[model samples]
Target chain A: MKHIKVFKTTMIASVVMSGLSVSSASQAANWLMLQGTEPAAAAGRAKVWGFIQAQYQKDQSDAGPTPSGEGYIPPKLIGPNLNSQQQFNVNRARLGVRGIGMPLDSRVNYFLLAEFGNNGITAPGGGDAHLTDASITINTDATRIRAGLFKIPGPEETLQAIHVFDYINFSEVSNQLMLERFPQSVDTFQGATDTPDASMGQYSRALGAVRDVGVQLFDSFQSADWDHSYAVMLGNGNGLNFGDNDDNLDTYLYWSSEMQFGGKGPRAEGLKLFAWNHSGKRTNAYNKTQEQDRKRSGVGVKYLQKPFRATFEYMQGDGMIFQGQHRPTMVFNDEEADGYYVDFGYYIPNTNWELDLRIDSYTRGENFIHPVNATLNSAASDESTFDKTTIGAQYHINKKTRINMEYSDRSFESDTATVNAQLEGVGARMAVQLTHIF
Target chain B: MKKFLMIMACLLSFSIQASPDSKPFAEKRIVLQISDPDPFKQTLVLNVANNLINHYGQDKVDIEIVAFGPGLRLLFRENANVDRIDGLTNSGVQFSACENTIKGMTKQLGHAPQLNPSAVHVSAGVVRIIDLVGEGYQLIKP
Candidate 1:
């Protein structure tokens, strides 16, 4: 009942926010100065910008039979899979103010963005007004320094803003592997607490949005036909919406080169190649003593030219979650994981239309092995693989408004403990969204 | 007491007249910053400009595109976006090239290169953006 009330409150807030006029006085440039004691400096300006995305999504999957046996399935694996569901809701309603305050003679740029679109969907930090970006960037001739809550320097798609996602949803591999594992309280693991609600495990896990509190240094060097860039970041590996959960800090490094193909200009108009690495340690919520080592590395390439673009990324990681989007059972040790995806998009010439297609594949070890006989490693019982194919279309009504429709077919390959051994099932989803920006 | 009342009335009237509803759309200013030289990103910038013009009518909106760093290539005569730039310029949009970047490029290319006829050279791109913001222009970097 309390959860329902919370949902109601969030819905009311969302409705109020949606009814707000885009040109309201609160969105005016002078509103910032008016709220503060500081005089309107000659170099300070604030611009309010954001977008609302309303979507209807539905997914249907065939579940193989449930596994039975006392020790064969861990306590954590006793519940039903939550991925087979259909939902309709506002996917995102984000509003933010970003501008230069001229604090360092305009060389220091600051941005603060928050989102209030978390009611209908189960996403990490999705249910309320949450910070998306709080960063102060200092730009210099040699390098740029950015610090605060920001997107981690990783895959191109992960770094891209959610408002500009090419499809209705992120690629399966990106959605599952690129983010930090969700933390679970010791009480929750022991079934000692009902507040988080055992059934809401998946939703709770969904809270780790792919952002971290960090500082990043980056710069770009360009030549006649190519541009090369590098960035180094240090972050608290914890998800956004909160402070660091542990004393350890995450480190990331990225390097990329973009080269123009046949273009006479120095601009990188055609091809892009990049590589990234992340190394860190994270506190295990269920067992404080087991502070886990986290590492991820990947390489990617992209071809961009006019009406056609293609991108491919391959990444591998060693962490708690294996073969799924959530953490593993305590009895099972976290294993090495790898995943990759390829995406292609084309815009219709002379029209506000576009088409997109993506294919993703991921494989990892099992989430549980009998605690007493943990060494029992069998390929038929300890591995899971997932593959997905998606195709979508988008229509741009105007610069600030867009409509997208997508269809996806997903399959899971697993060593099912089910009596029937029905390890293969296809899940399909159809989604449509309308986004308007102000 | 009469003088105090008179002063309050004048202040109220000024506040009412300064409201956004009383302001004309044509008086609004926007600055689009282009610092990345990626053609696709530059194309998105132009797309944003065209959309704003279409929505508000070119005459009702004052728009300026400020290019710096590698983004200066957008204003080159051989730029892939020159035609688009010409069309937007014809629609009353203004384009500014950073003088600092131009000087650096000239030094590197060993010649004083040419820019599109519509592009006006500014002393410095960041400083130009700051000045424009001081004048109430909304800055958008895409």
Candidate 2:
């Protein structure tokens, strides 16, 4: 009788274990929510992670002549000293630590990352290391609050996880318009006589790298089959510096809705629609007493599914615009500009190969104020349109490593025939990079 | 008394054979092991399991995913793949969470970690794999 009772008890235990069930809750996929966040249940004191990108890039454009017999300088890769046609570089090497306040309180988490690469983040200042992200987030039932130096909510290209970026270089629009470059000194040089013996020199202090010191409130939620996210941030207009340049603070707003397709992680499969705007005031270094309005806004759509991917983005800028350098002259002033890009990709079935193509165009200086003969003059610049088409291929060596190869066909345009002819020398570029995440 | 003892032995053996939570007529059994922390690997393991189910009818095959070490992150309640886990659960796939890892994490975390409802606690991930293998299941480390 005792043995029979034991048998019945064992059967009951088995039945109870097999019948276990729990209530289900809905979940959403938001990179912002997933990237730096630790799971509430397994929140650790410290977790370290990072990635490295090594690359070689070459500019194929050749110097040519303008109609006036003046030499036309072809574009060069932007780097230290800024004149290399081809070179090998450790483009990005970053390490970061992230964790929640475990035994104390899981609601608070922190993320800190540093850059040790030969790129804009460090090279501009000749520094060996640059702190890119240092932020702390507090989670609540309603929303999450993050504070410190971090990437502002804006373009998908800038907001997404950089380690998984599909391309080695950013689009022309994102590069020139979004990536803030700070000038070391004001440009006092006018035309010929007043031109400083030395050029303003490559932005000597810092590169924004699409980051700002700010405080943001953000969250993500699921409704039906879609995951929606939103963020509002207030930041110092200055790039990497912790302090604001002017009394005016930058305001950023972003929203995204993604239709989840049953995948996870940074490269999840989804169709996302997003829009964002950033507005701020910059204290002009050239005219210290004067503050210029800076505004940027964008809208885009991205889709990722098995064997196919597509992205399209359109951006606009008003007021302060970076005009880059012309000989020893540095230009930054109020201007109007716009740009757009379309990218498509295909993954070969049963293979590790993926092919991609992208077309991008940008028109700058719609209302450019030219510095001529030691005086500021209003002019409609004819040489302002830039376009490029990029063909790329990626080979996934393993889950954490991949090789990327790309060739870009570049071109320039102007209303003046001679200016257009002079820009014809602008040519193609090729780059190859290997990325590993650990 | 000898006859009664024999009958008890037979019944115990039969109960042990029927105790597995798998479909009665499953033609194939697979146990997938995930021991890496990489999110890509975690997602790939699920993809492999889905592909297997697509190839073999869900009723014809039984699948169990065993996670240990850092791979336990995949079974966290707030994991990014919560929807995928729910879908797979409804499809009859099972997820086994290693209790050993949970205890280690608890020590480091100062509190016990919460797991997805779909994940069933197992004494150890490797031992679970071994038990499944002993039951004629194929082992795949994806």
Candidate 3:
């Protein structure tokens, strides 16, 4: 930490000295960060930023082996921890950074970014960190073109900011989306049991991966009464930071359009439609077994009427294979899964407090392919569903940070095994995260 | 060419209406304006424009948006549709940049925002609002 501070000061001094002799034009022209900020940079140029979040989660129920991954068969696909003493544990402390460059002439040109869950979301060493998003933009009026590791939406899920969701983990449907973002979130990946294969547990961020990275072009259309914007991207099939394996590259599309509905006020009134899509890829396991091409898709809607904002989205991946007695890549017939979520929040017009609620539901495709529990069995119909609900509030300390608290209620139902695995469980996600936008 | 010619005709006719001699208030309607330093809000404003363009036709209605403060960005000079500014501006899309905010805000951001001289430079956010309202621009903060 001390070394970084010294390094920052030195770099600034060199630039400041160089800038000292130059005219205000050059000084103003040479963008540097607002010197006092942590994400060091120049003025006139966009700034860079990053953050760290610490969180904890507990499953109120004891997990048994099942199609999804772990836990005893609950009456539903998602439910509370059944036995506190044997409950599973989830904890996270993560950090990331953002880099915006100094502006040049005629343009307030700069980069926008974020990263956490280790350089890679699924990288080894188990630190929940990742290079979330990094993109550059050339601005002009209400229109601009952005390129770099950017966001592509198919679902309401945050493609570049996955960890911000109120729930500690993503829904099942979100996990299956294009390139199987964060496979661990669906089930143990190991069809074998509710308990993870201790050897590889260190590799995956129990929360999983984010699928946004690629070059995108964006622009806006505006009028006195309303405004609209759109973005399109081409990226790695395996979400951001997943790196290239043999997996093929894919294309993504995102469009957010809206209008001022019945408005005659001091505030703008409107409703919007935001949708996104990605090319899905099959793992080596599924490819060897099935020749079918699978894909991921998502749609979301947002409406803002003064102090109220409501958003709902559904996203899904066509084919995936979790870990199993076979191999981690083995594909089974009809093995595809997806999920949906609806979230709404209200904040007093001029206050920092917001009331929020979200409902998420999903199914593990393979939950129908096999069963857990060495003895008693359940039917496939009984094991495929999983879902959860969360109602919460957030207090914004300021523009760059906020603290959130929520109550989570969940349940799951399985057929083939006595106890369903990961998808069905009741739990609480207690977390605190810091965020900043540059 | 026909569509282009038609759009051109519509643009020319609309400009004539903003003239004080030809007030557009003969119809029961209103105009709105947005000016914010926010990127999200700027994007939203554009969408609103699209909605108005589609529903009201660029020619039939009187619409104008005045931007200032850090808001000068919405119309970055090099934006791909740099020409869109002219298309909107010529058709009565009044753009205003805050001279005071521009002086200090640009210093903070590192450089001055790319702006066309054609954009009106107001001395302050408050004054800009008052001036536009005085000109009968409906006030809307989206």
Candidate 4:
């Protein structure tokens, strides 16, 4: 019924943004913002944070019978594949307002933030989370500037940082080159639409997106433990759809740097390195006859001590376009696609412990693109080439609860009508999480 | 009396360095404006800008946080909301972006966030919030 009244108006705007960040219903001597077993470094001040997570899942599918047509070709769908052990849930509820301020004056100091999440379980605005980020930051004596809603500078294993995720996703030909570094439409928190029913993940964004609006620029230069950084961006070519078309554009650019080889904390922090670049184009077109193009590049590296966590990544993709003035028989071929991955993890080195182990692999070649653009190909049943493999786990019972797990195995080497139109089987997924922090 | 016990040990180390909430007045100057993206709200806005930079210190209170929308992934450099711009760009945290993001080059389709300009480009965002409330700053929003 109108998508359940747009999921009751995005769950009443997330219970009025968690009651405007607490402080209500007078009664219960409180001043909450608690939950921390460790992850300290309050370092310097302006604080208001939060957290919450929940999950459950299990799956399997192959439609009975073994080998119902060899080359029955089945693999790389990039969308839809779930429902085997239902009760799937994932959450991240938040509110923000950081500290320290002086707008390029008073010698320098700065920060600002905001967030909200929930994108799973029967989906629709209840998987509704909005306002991905709102920023403000500055550092002097070496230079820096990081505007708002940023970070989509071309997949280098997605720039690592999900508390540092190495596996749980890999193979599917390395997630189609890390799903072209975030950007999607629809999954509305169940509100506002001229067009949008579904299609958010398989890349990024879900239920109310605009993940990283636009604006970014960077600079970092450090020695005495080693650190280097470089960046670039010029967003809003409609990557988060705000439409009203005016030369239609979506821009983002990036360059990375990391170094700390050994000598920080937690058994000597190990190693790091990263690099990236990405490009896009589509500009103005509604009466059909629209044009498109893209480019992506990559590099990655990381390592940690103690429980041994490792990572490696490589990426390459160029000029990926679609719609030549209205499906001229659906084209494919701009040429150039590359991807790679590696992972390692173990944690018995507990103290306030959290543990994880991992594995991943990637590959490419299925009508790849980037040949100075124009003319596409792949689907003479999908011209063969794709790969995948994954295994993962995470456990932290205290300090705000957590328990996660995953297992995946996929393979495809098509051609001949894409082995009869892909979807080879061997999939299983699971989850369990409960988190709290304020 | 040994100079009154060294002035009562310098008034007990200046009342233990102004413990908790004891700032009668002098200490209120802010300048923060970021754009969003969500990495746990960029670590909950860097844990409230590390307690307002330790309740005002980075030189007797003065800070700056100006990033463009999508909150520039803490200064994106391959950031898919991952490196958090190297976990908060070397501590001192200060950045600025927005040249309408990056002029134009097409092929977006969607998921915008991720801008980097090497730093500083205050050409918009409502003219830098009316020039930081007319250079008096004190506006705070993450």
Candidate 5:
């Protein structure tokens, strides 16, 4: 309570000081409607934009050293701790600047952005600022070429800004397949019937930084009623701000089109269809450092109408992260996985209130491979699947401030003898968040 | 905890000192962009203009509205929002209509099209915006 009061006081004081400054400035300037506080600058001049997201998450999963006399321990996925724990965090603190160069030809524009927030949402480590975007665009009226660190052409949901996401947490499929980080604790499974090699755990690495260092060429084909666009990129497979970690480069391609159903401008409404391909390579087996193939493809649809919106996406991939689990001494084998999600949202006719729902699921099609010398039998035909459903509501206090509340139910099931010992369970979580844009 | 507090103090100081709002100048200049073909969006642009004029007063702020492509229709003589446009113009807001769009529309209609009398024809809407921004005019695409 005391902390909350302190935070509120500080925030109010800042806004008051800012208001005084804006009201007293004597210069002739254009005022930004949404970003009203920005200092006036010319069209070709660079300007800064950013937002902050702070949140609290509570997990209701009954996960501990072991589950109610179960013979083995299940891998932790929902919370950062080895056991379910609640947390308060600054999820994303981002800052960015973009504009056409003031002196250079108007055709040339540049953007650079960075995040000083939590590194791993469900884990430890990462209290440093990291670059998220650094791109230069040379564009004509309809076509453009962009090079540097940017988002890979993939799922539209992955490409959307986190501040705009309707749900507190992303769909299960996006979390497991796209972010790709696996649980790291071997301590919880120490007494299990089949012990994993604790020293070989891959917990040090996190997957699914959506953006990569890349170059993309994109253009649009437009008519009075529709807009069609396409983009292709080649990038270093490694996530944000880093050079390629492997010898092979990654490739991404996307195509999309929107057909207007409503009149033009803010009232213009449309339905869109999009498809993308992601192909890359990843290193497997920590000791041997063997190179392996990674491929993914997806298709989705989106509908944008005033006060209502909906999106659906499906994706499949085959990679070295055996059966979607990264563990110490895990075998390096080809595994295929697929997932999909449906999201729907609506806003109250004349209020700041909004309602939303989402369903997400993922299936791993390969066997939960076991260590070669394990004491328990490796059930080769067993498979695992995950599902999650979320119901949420949001209220826009104004254009720049918002509050969100969400409830989610998640379930995991597997048929393998090794995992059935402790893996099959259901968990529920509730979260609330506050977002401010500047 | 101490380190966190120190960081927050530094950030707040920087936020205040680095505010882009403190440039030494004689006047405030603003540009409004209407690139969407929707009349509803154009009205929103006008609303923003009115709000700014109300807050800063018409005499203190320099305002311009730039339109092109499908957005050019916002300045058509028969536009649904012509009265709103004229009202804003009366308060010193300038409107720039893109000649490139006018030419395209004229070719499509097989005759030269007419724009609202309040609009000043420009070679290109985007170029006008670029030039204005270079002169330190902040853009507000409401």
Candidate 6:
């Protein structure tokens, strides 16, 4: 243990030294700085921008029978009420206006965006319009303070501007862990039976979209050629809700150091090292008196230079894990979970084409009991593992538009053999999406 | 811990100062600002610089182009006008890149953008232009 601690210290020291040594007077910029701060030269009072993603996805596997031979469940997308084998949908339709204060005050800027899509952000609430980002930032020499509804500083995949996301779908780990889903209850035994209705207790509101109402203090500084940034935010633990559910607030801490390679805009080339931690408490929707601890943390490195780009991240969670529907019920447990993902892409030189590959794995519900049947009073300690490998390609039609095609091979495992058999023959999925930014 | 502090000190020592002092001997001093992201505008500014050099003679005139905001793209390492920038530098023309713009871009792009090696750092392009104008240099926003 002593040696391990020393080794960890040395590694951290080395990373810090490397970041400091590469410092110079000039280099790159960061996404958060660009979005939160206004440029000195003001063009207008408000500038509008947004993107739209139209997608078509199909499940490649055939419907298979469960181990019990009672019924058949078709392979579906990794979301609630999306059991269809094929569908075409506008995954995202977002529009917003952002700019400095009227009459040209660069120190104060605001960002406002709304979602008009048929995805989780709108579908769960059965609403056509949903506000995703509405924040005002006050800039000072030392730091910037932003308040309102905004994204939580978390994983790169979650924190970075979504319009430039290279993949059609998020990695499994990010989907299950970071892309939060708020259910009304944690009582798995409330309607427990031998065969519960699969859709009875599912989440009706797919809110959160990774945003919270809060205030954050963040800034980035340059040292030689490296740019280091830090953000500390205090937020209402409730996701996207205007009011806090409990007295306790969520605290988020994030730090990143990057070495610039060149380029500009969302696709710039750089090497970044980042880590973040999020801790909060969630009150059970059904049992208001009961609250569960929710904590998540991650560390990662991302490198992007011209033709080659790669990112790897490892994440861990303790308490309040979102276990997907066990046939007829959604389960939330105070259990431990961990996940990781590695993504690599290559942009063909002098061409508007890029190829991408990503692999991700997640394990949830460690040593947690699930009622097999309430009538028999039988329970089992259930655990599940999910893995996915996605191969994709992007064809850039122009600077503001691109088409992406992806094929994903997915697999699921459970400690219960019967559950494993039910998830067998889970096959590949194909998706094609076109995105245009204005 | 001691060794780590020593290395940090060494790194800090290499920090370069922003903006160079004015040249006193030059007959004419001019500062040009490029604040737009249009590629055509970028090329036009370079053309204007070339015209000024041709008319005044390279040694007789001092020219500096200060870029900020969207116009910072002109100083990008991969910019198409890299050859022109190199030619202008050889003709004694100076290029100044704004740190504010870099910071803004860094915040947006998630990293500091690589700039042309010939470009000198300035805390802010607008301030740099103001300083140059105060130093008897004519300011042009073309």
lDDT winner, 1 or 5: 5
Off by over 4 Å in 3: A1-43, A64-102, A105-130, A137-147, A159-172, A175-208, A241-243, A260-269, A283-292, A321-334, A348-351, A367-383, A418-438, B1-115, B118-142
> What would the per-residue lDDT of candidate 5 be over residues A1-438, giving only the tens digit for each residue?
554566577677546533333322311111011111111111224667888888888766543234432332323332333322367878778888876553213346677888876644323333366777788776554456788887776786776567767877878677666764423333111333223222222344444468778888875554544566678889887766367656778898988777756643322457878898989876653533677677888999888786898889998888744443334334244667889999888988989999999998888654444445454444655566788889999999987789999998877776664555445433677899999888
Model 1 lDDT tens row, A1-438: 554555566467445433221111111111111111111111224667789998877655443343432111111121122322455667678887765563213346677777677431234423456677787777564676888887777787776566667787777567667755455563233211112123334325434466778888875555655656678989888767457777999899988777656432211246878899989886766677887777788999988686897999998887655333223344224566788999999989999999999999887665543334544324443666778889999999997789999998877665534211333334577889999989
Error of 5 at B140 (Å): 18
Better of 2 and 4 by DockQ: 2
Worst 10 residues of 2 chain A by lDDT: A190-199
TM-score of 1: 0.62
Cα lDDT of model 3 by residue, A1-438, tens digit: 554555566467545433322211111100111111111111234333445444333435445433445543322112122122222222222333333343224333444443443232423334444454456555443444555554454554554244345444455455434333233223243333343222322124322244455655555444443445556666765455546443566776666665656542212346666666666454443244443345667777766675787777777666553422222333333355667888788886688888888888876554343434544533434435667777778777775566666666766654544334443443444333344333
Q: Sorted by TM-score, highest first, which candidate order results?
A: 2, 6, 5, 1, 3, 4
Q: Estimate each model's TM-score.
A: 0.62, 0.73, 0.56, 0.25, 0.65, 0.72
TM-score of 5: 0.65
- Model 4 residue A314 lDDT? 72
Instruction: After the best TM-score superposition of candidate 4, give how far the Cα of residue A131 lies from its true spot, in angstroms.
Output: 24
Across A68-143, the per-residue lDDT of candidate 6 in tens digits comes to 5222232344333454557788879999998755412345789999999877677764678888889999877568
Number of the top DockQ candidate = 2
What is model 2's native contact fraction? 0.11
> In order, what lDDT does every prediction score?
0.63, 0.75, 0.48, 0.42, 0.65, 0.74
**Per-model i-RMS:** 22.1, 8.2, 21.5, 22.5, 16.9, 12.5
Which model scores highest in TM-score? 2
Alpha-carbon deviation at B15 in model 3, angstroms: 19
The DockQ assigned to candidate 5 is 0.03
DockQ of each: 0.03, 0.13, 0.02, 0.02, 0.03, 0.07
Q: What is the lDDT of candidate 1?
A: 0.63
- Chain A alone, TM-score per model: 0.76, 0.86, 0.65, 0.28, 0.78, 0.86
TM-score, prediction 2? 0.73
Per lDDT, what order, best first? 2, 6, 5, 1, 3, 4
